[model samples]
Each structure stands twice: as C-alpha cells, then as structure tokens.
Target: MQQRFETIEQYLEWMGNNNFTNMTWDIEATGLLDETSIDYTASPYKIKPSYKHHCIVVEEHGGNILAFYDGPTYVFDGREYTERLPKASSMLHTEEVVTLKDYTPVEYIHLPLKEFKNYVLKRKIKRVVAHNMINFDLMSMKLVEDMDFTIGVEHRDGGLTTWSADTWMGKQVVFDDTLVISKTCNPDLFGGHSLDKLSRRAGGDTKIDFRKHLAPDVRFLDFAADMLYYCIYDVKANTAVWHWLQDHEDYQLSDRDNYIKNWLSPIQLEKKVAEIITYQEHRGFVLNVDLCEKAVKDLDAKMEERRARVEPVLPPRPATKKFMADYTPPKRQFKQNGEITSYLQKFIERIGAQLKEGDDRTMIFEGKEYKLPLPADVPLKTEMPAKIGDTTHIKQWLMGEFGWIPSEWKETDLTVDQKKIKLPMENIVAKIDRWLDVTYSTAYKEERLDGFGDYMKITPRSTRAYVRQRLIDRASKGSCKVLTNPSFTKGQEKEMCPDLERIAEQFPFAKDVIEYLTFKHRRSAILGGGMDWDEMEDGEEPEKGYLASIRQDGRIPTPADTCGAATSRMKHRKVANVPRITSLYGAELRELFGVGDGFFQIGYDFDSLEARKESAYCDQYDPTKEYCKSLMMEKPFDVHTMMAKRISEIIGRQFNRSPAKNVKYGLTK
Candidate 1:
C-alpha cells in the first residue's frame, strides 16, 4: 500500500518520486503582439514556437534541457532528444535531486520544437503551472500549433469555447498560472508579484536573470547550458511559490470564504470575469458606420461653405504700415526742463488742447465715462488701401499707427475714409492714412471634422443638450417609463430637458447639427461618431454585442465605466442597477445584444427582496407586532394610501370639501 503524505514536504516528495510532470514555460519571441491589429473578430497575434528556442524543465527528476536545434542530444524510450545542460545551478537540484543515490536511474529527454506540443499532449499531464502562461506560453502554443488548453472548468460551463472546439483537449488537462493568484494573495506587495520576487519570498535556493539570455538568432548549442539552468530554476521557484500558497493560512482562509461563503473560488471568479471580458472584446457593438461617415462628410462640407461666405470680409493685408513694421511704441517719456519729452509730451499736449488741462478727455455713455487717450507723436506713413469696406479698418489703422483707437464705433457712424466721423479723433490723421473695416459680425463657424477625420469635439453644454434631446425624444413619444413618470421630480426631468429654447436661440443652426449628433451618439455606443476599428481585426466587422469587466470587489463595469453595478449585497459607493440599460437604451440598440448562436441568456431577479427583508427586520424589532403581519397579508396593504387616508381623517374636520378631496390633498402633501 502507498503511504499517504500529510505534510507539504512529504507531498512534494511523493510528487517528485511518482506523480510529478515536467513542462517548459519560457518563450523567446521577437516582440509582443500588435494590439492595434486585434479587435472585433480577430484574436491577438500568437507567437510560433518554431521561430525561437524552447526550454523545458522536468519537475520530477530535477532535469532541464534546451531543444529545437541540431546538436548532441539524448534519447529516452526511443524519443529523439536535444542537448542536455548541467542541473547543479537549478534550485530544485538542491531541494529534490541532490540527495539521490548515484546509481539511481535518471532519464533526460529532448525533442525538436515541432514535437514539443505532441509530447505534452501525449503525456496527458493533469496540471501544468507557469507564470503568465495564459498570455505568453499558452497563447504562443495556440498560435503556433493551434492547440487549446482549458484554464478552469467554469470557463467551459457556457458554450464560449465552441469556436475552438476542434482544437480543445479534453477537460482532463488544465493550465494553472501563478501571476493573478500571487497578486490576489499578496496585494500588499503591489506591483511586486513578479516570478523573481515570488521565488525569493518562497525561499528558493537559486535565481536567474532570464532577460540576459534572449538571443533569438544565437544557436542553442552556445547557450544551452545556461538557458536550461535558468529554465529549471524558474520552474523550481514557481513550484515553491505555489506550494507556499497552498500551505499559507491566509490564502487557505480566503479560499474557504470564497468557496463556502460566496460559492465560488477567487480563481473561478477570475476565470468567469476573463471569459466575459473576452467575449465582450470579441463581440463589439454594431454601428451604422456608413451613416456616420456620410453625416460627418456632409457636416464638413456645410461648415466649409459657411466659412467661405465670411472669407471675403476679412482684410488681405495689415491696415497700416506700423502694423507691417516690427516697431514698438514707448511706454513713457522723461521730463526735460520741466516739460515732458518724446512721444508722451506730444500726446499730453494734444490731450490738453482737446480739454481743460486739469481734466481728462472722456466720453459719457450709459452712465459711465470712458477715457480716450490721445495719439502719440509717432511718424506715420501712407499704408491704408485706397478703398476700404467698413469702420473696423479705420480703427485697425488708427490703433497700429498712433497706438490709440476709439474703443467704440458703429458701422453707420463712420465715413469710407474715416475722416467725416462724428466722434473724437475726427481729423487726427490724414484721410490717405485711414481705412474702413468690414462691419460683418465675426461669428466662429467651427468645422465639423477634425484633422483626423473624426467629429469635432463638443463642449459640455452640447453634451448636456444631446442627453436632454434623447430624454425629451423618449418622453414625448412615451417610449421610456422613467422619463415620462408623472410622479418623478421636476429637477430630475429638467436634467434631460433643461431649457432647449435657450440652446436653440443661442445656436439656431446647431439645432439640426445637434440632432444629427444625438442620433449618432445614442444609436451607436461611441460618442462623436468615431468608431475604433483597431479594436477589432483589420477586415472583420465589429460583433453586435456588449462587453463588461467584473472587478474582484463584485462590481462589473461596462466600457468607459459609463454603466456598471455591484454583485455583492454589501453597500458600495454609487452602486447602479445593471438592468437599467434596458430602460436607458432604445429597443433597436438593445436588440443588438441578442443571444449568440447555440447560447441563450438567462436573467433572474429577487422580486422585492429588499422590501421583504426590511419588513422582516422591522417586525423583529416592532413593539406593536403588526408590521410584518400587515406586510404578509394576501391582499397586500397600500401603505402610502392608508397613511394618506389616516392623515385626511385627522385634517378633514377643518375642511368643508368632500372626503375624497381631503385624501387627495393629503396624498399630495
């Protein structure tokens, strides 16, 4: 009979002697997958094992090898082997193989890169552990050899992997990774859950700097010894860390809470989340891409046309030679012989000529006097055009030449040459040096498309208007119950319908533009009508579905955190109801998330669960002993109406109106 091992050390010994399995985890790849190429229908890029060296560490016998090259190799049980490296540098050698008898038989086997996958499949290994195995090792295997390995059993509960059905090995095999597990177990070690750190924490005897051996072009013959030793040490360290976790009291307590209390282990929950996230990533929402593109193009053309109308009104050149020159006006002048010198002296003299020496020249309008500074004594040149269109040009030229211009002027109040003006500075400069400015209103016609061909960014006001229009559209049509509820507060309704007239009067042309934008924003899940094609594969259409991410704290977030809700009963900040999407989104948009082929969505809720729980708790503490009984009555009492009637009875004596009217007034109160 076999002896049962009770301790971790004894179990490890048993595993080493009889139940152990070997797996090589390190990968030599040119680079990570291009994220931009993955989206909608295409999976992330997979690395091919054949393109780089393969290192395998055998756990049972503390052996390691570097394979996939034509060099001196070993064979075990008629299988072709690759070069063997010394195990003295391995951490597992000190712990497991150092005390073995010299005459004990030890077999080292290595195969070509192409045969590695076949060997793993043939061995029927039950559990394979590695760090970051899902992204690096397993993804590389799937990409290179088209093999599918299950990570957890719950992931197979739904028909999610039906696409990979042909390549999926049976449930007898599963791959376990330590990256997420370690992070969850040791969250205080934030951002320090790398394999090296975990190995040290687990008291491993050896360490290797694996990044130093990444010479993909170098032949395996030159670095086999070091590469094999590093691989073995990594495996040993990973195993040690995993064993440490299994024996850890805190980890065990957490596992028990997750299983016994939550009915799902942390690993199971993580797998479920990964599955959902992957599905959502692959199943992107459908959009009317063609409609959006056309809308953007038409809006761009309209904006350009409007801009062209205003282009002829602007001046082709500076209004004065001073504006064209790089000269700057002096700030002040010093006094000479009790008289101010430079341009300031002439400016002050001119001001004294126009008004009393002690009083400044002022123009009074609307109960306020605006001081108009006199022009400085600067040299002037004839730079104005012979024929100008409006008074703005006269002001521009005056400002450039004399560093002074009338702060206020009307189009009808000025002459063509600005000489016959009815206000101050009427004849300050010669008519040839004055020009008119075009009087057209200067309004900005923002372009619809940006430099990248996406819609122009909108202001927060416009965003609010878009949301308001959506709510109003839904409410007016009686399509949404929440928006159209008669009892709902005015403030809540105003959030979605705040003074549309103000918006429309402010931007008359923007009404149609905003309507088009609202349609694009609400119909499609993307704002500004910009679809991220890089989220999916190059040529594939986005999948018609929604994706959500489930956090460990029991919250699931939709894209951009726009929508989310909690799963646990515990109170959380700003917890939302996930099912409210049905109420918020229109039917056409909601229908996009149809059940995929061979699968159906099952949704259930605890009907009035909170109200019942509240009633029970109240009854337990009630001195009257009637609250729970009243709640449990078959007919069910209208608590609000009953309270209203009781209040009406108390107040009806003061009123001559009918009892029904009294109750109605009470209910309103």
Candidate 2:
C-alpha cells in the first residue's frame, strides 16, 4: 500500500525516508536590491545576488506532494544553521507586501544548501518543472560552486514556453516551457501567459500575490513563513494550469492534428523561434561609436554653415502695427483693424462694373447686399470659373493695383526678358520664402542624422528630443509658428503661407527636402531604419550585430512590426527585424555595416519568387494546362519587357517616346 501525505511537511518527511525526485518547482526571491542603483554597464558580473526567500518542489504524480525550502538559515535535525541563498536573481521583481492573515506555514526539518543539493543528486531527479527556470532558478542553482551536480532532470519553463534538456559536460537533462503551449491553445486568451492568469483561467482557486508581503529590500528571514507559503502556492497553481491544459480533449485533438500536418505543432514552431531569439540576444550586436560620433560632428558643422548662409536672407520679425477698422468687400464692416480697407473697396467697385445681372453674384460677406462682380467674357453661366469661385479676380486686382508680380509666374514665350517688379512687403515675402526653404531643408537633414545616430552611441530617446529641438529652432527663425504646432500639416503650409509652394518649385533643395521627409514618414511593411542597442558592457568592443523577437506565429519582428513574414516558402530569403543593408543607397552609410572580425555576412535570394509561386499555384490548380510553361522555360525572362510589349500590342500603338515628352504633349492637348 502507498502512503499519502496531506501536507508539505508530511511530503518532506516521506522524501527523507524514501527517494522521490521527479517534480515541478518554483522559487521566491525576497529582499532584492534595486537594479537601477547597480552599475551593470560598468561591471555586470560584480552585481550581488538577490536573496532567495523560499524554494518549493511538488511531485508530478506522487499524490501531488510538495516540499518547501527556505534560506539565510535552515534547521537540520532540529539544529538551526546559516546557509547562503542562490546567486541567480529572479527575473520578476516587485515591491508588493505578502499577506498572512489566513495562511499557515508548514513546519518541517530543514536541510542546509549542501545537504539539500546532495539529497536531490542522490535521488537522481528525472524532471524539474518551473516557470522561467532556465534563466532564473536553475541558473541561480548552477552558480553554487559546491553543488556541481549534473541537472539530469528535465528542466521546464512555463513563462517563455521553451525548453532544453541537452547535457553539458556529460550530463543529460530535458527542458521544456509551457508558455507556447497555452498561447498556441488560445492566442486570444484575455490575460497573458502569467501564472496567476493561467491558473484562474484553468478554474483553479489558488492566488499567490507576491506584492502582498515583503518589500523588495526586506530580509528573507523576516518573512520566511509567508514567503514559503506563497512559493508553494505558485508551484501548485503552475502545475494545476499545466494539468488543465493536458486534460483538455479539444486542445489535445487540435494540437495532435496540427503536429501531424505540419511535422511540428504551433507550440513547437514558437519554441524554435524563441530559441533563435535567445541566441541572438546573447550574441549582442556591435556598435560603431567612433564613426557615429564623427558623422554627428560633421553634420553639426554643415548645419551651422548652411544656417549662416540662409540667416542673412531670412525676413526680420514683422513690426507690430495698429490701424483703424475698415470695411471689406460686399460692404461688410470689418471687426479687425487693417490698412487694406481702402484698397479692398476700390477693388470691389471695379468688380461690380464687370458683373452682369443674371450671373451668379454671391456676397463675399454673409448678410450683406454687396455682390461679387462676374467678368463679362464669362462664356458659360452653368459652371463657375476659377477666377470667380476661388476669388482669384480680387487677387489679380490687388496685384495689378499694387504692382506685385509673383516670382513664379512667367510669360508664355521663352524669349521674353522678364522685369523684376517689387510691391508692398515684397522683400519681406521673399525673405520669408527663403527662410522657409532653408529651415525646412535643415530640419530634414538634422532629423535623418539624429534618427540614424541612435544605433551608434546615442540613445534613441535622447535623439528624439534633439529632433524636436531642431524643429523648434526652425520655427523660431521667423513667424513660422505653424512648424512648431502639433496639428500642422504640409498641405496646410501651402494654404496658410501662399509663398511656400512657389518657393518649393523654384528651389530644388526645398522640393527635395520636403519629398525626402515625406518618404521617411510613410509606413512600410518591411523593416528598415535606425538600430536599437542594449546597455553598453565594460570592455565590450564595437562590432556588427543583429536583433529579433519571435512572435507566437513564428515570425520575428521589431516593436514597430517592421519585419516578420508568414510564408514558409520565402521566410529564409527575407531578413526580418533588421535593416535592408543591400538596398541602402549611400556607399558611406553602407560601410557602417561591414562585418567585424570573426564574423562573416552573406546574402542569397530567390529569383522572381512571387512570380514563381504564382506559376506553381496555377499549375497545381490545373494539371492539364501549362499556363506559364513558356515563361518558366525562358531563362532570365524579362517580365517587365514582356508585359510592356503585350500592353502595346493590345493598345495597337508603340510607346517609343520619353515619359516626360508624352506627359507634356498629353497635358497640352
């Protein structure tokens, strides 16, 4: 007959009497120091280990018996003795308090760290399951020099849903994680893969709130009783969720079917992705600090030189003037004072004489009898002309009266020697135009460099601040307050400031700058842009590196979803979560990604991958027909040329003319 233990104490006593090793485990670390205060960048290995408050192990099947262990002090055969806590720190840290109102701690004989390790080694433990066991619990245990026992058991992680049981130095151990298991079962599960959430979703009543007891810095001995209970509860909850998932018939059936079809279950695929990501993270990417610093310095010098050249041409701040209130067109009273009232009235009278009675004569001012005059030459009354609808006639009248000639408007003939006519505030307007062009261009260059510099030594967060400052500086140059406003749009700039578009057309730099900014702002499905860096380590050398994060769908992506493709056919060809180095245009910029010592970069891609796939699919759907046989057989077939020829044949015309010439003629006709 087998003996059944009701409590953890009884279980420990049974373990002492007879060997029982296969178990699920969890550990609670109490009184951890704040990592923010530690200088990990300067000396990562020097950081002190966090104190472990309790370690709980529950048997996989032996009546679900649990064994609890605590540290800083342990009692052996009724004798109390001191012991050091495990060196590995818990990944999850909190400052929450532990509640003990209704909880009771089980009393059992304690084994010192050495004895505890020996007892487990002698039992020849077959499996050890825990959430985040690899990076935390087992990692901490491995740091103990005296406890050099081979982890011969299957080590499992419930958080990341990954496992490794490969032997190190002739030791064989199995590892697995439950995170991917739960995620694959239900991707849309409300709460994430946290132990508390999983247990609740599995209909278990166990709730171990780590935040309910000790402060992050509190000693483990002070809260040993409560910590032990909390640790045990976590193990029980984790095991319960695992069991629930295994017992679910629907989940088992679906998982089995998927495994049979794909040769790997969804969870297994996710595990593979996780493994890749872990390896990449461990092999951190390199940074070219010197090159980045030099680039930024050079950019700053160029910006200053550009600023000096443009500042002289920028418009001085307009004088703050006051004037008497005046009437506008249609005889409406002007609420605001201005100097243009007399000029506006004269313009209105001239328009009235050209107006016809039957023509559409809407008042410019609401509730006013004054009607806008229409040109006598107006050919049609059915459609409103641009001159009338857009109020361009008033603008023409003003230009004629003030002798103001638009800088961009040119005569139809190329032989005409244009006269430079100046009008009221013409110099100021020209200066503002110049200012806008230079400032916008400067802002664009600065933003590009600032974004790219983050990959070097500069932090992305700080670089973002610098980008904002550049915009603010540009806005301060003139009355360009719109540039600083959050809601400002490029289209609005043309409307609010009439000269912006004209300047953009006249100055190639201005047009290029705006176009470049627009291109950078547009969202794309592929990944490209500045790189992100982890904290700098002491003695770490600059080198080329890569980063990736695996999703549940087995695709890797950066935070922006910039990478990660779903198709297996092209997955190996596409480099996800990294910049497209081959497509980068500038030679100087491309040189930054040169392979470092001991590392070699290589590139290979399928030819016409999408076209090939389409062809294959078409053939598969209809075996009797060869839809793409001729094209497939033709080596190095130019699809673009083939399509262009087909289009010309269908249209019954040859497209032998330049696109620009075609467009010019098309528009003229």
Q: Best TM-score goes to which candidate?
A: 2
TM-score of 2: 0.43
For every model shown, the clashing-pair count is 9, 12
Candidate 1 residues lying further than 4 Å off, grouped into runs, are 1-19, 22-24, 28-110, 122-126, 134-136, 151-174, 183-189, 192-237, 252-269, 272-288, 291-669
Worst 10 residues of 1 by lDDT: 481-490
lDDT by residue for model 2 over 259-301, one digit each (tens)?
4453234444554454454334323334344553454455445
* TM-scores vs. true structure, each candidate: 0.37, 0.43
lDDT of 1: 0.38
Superposed Cα deviation of residue 525, candidate 2 (Å): 18
lDDT of 1 by residue, 334-433 (tens): 4445334455445434433232346444423234443543233442222333222222332243234433312111111121121111222333222111
C-alpha lDDT values of all predictions: 0.38, 0.38
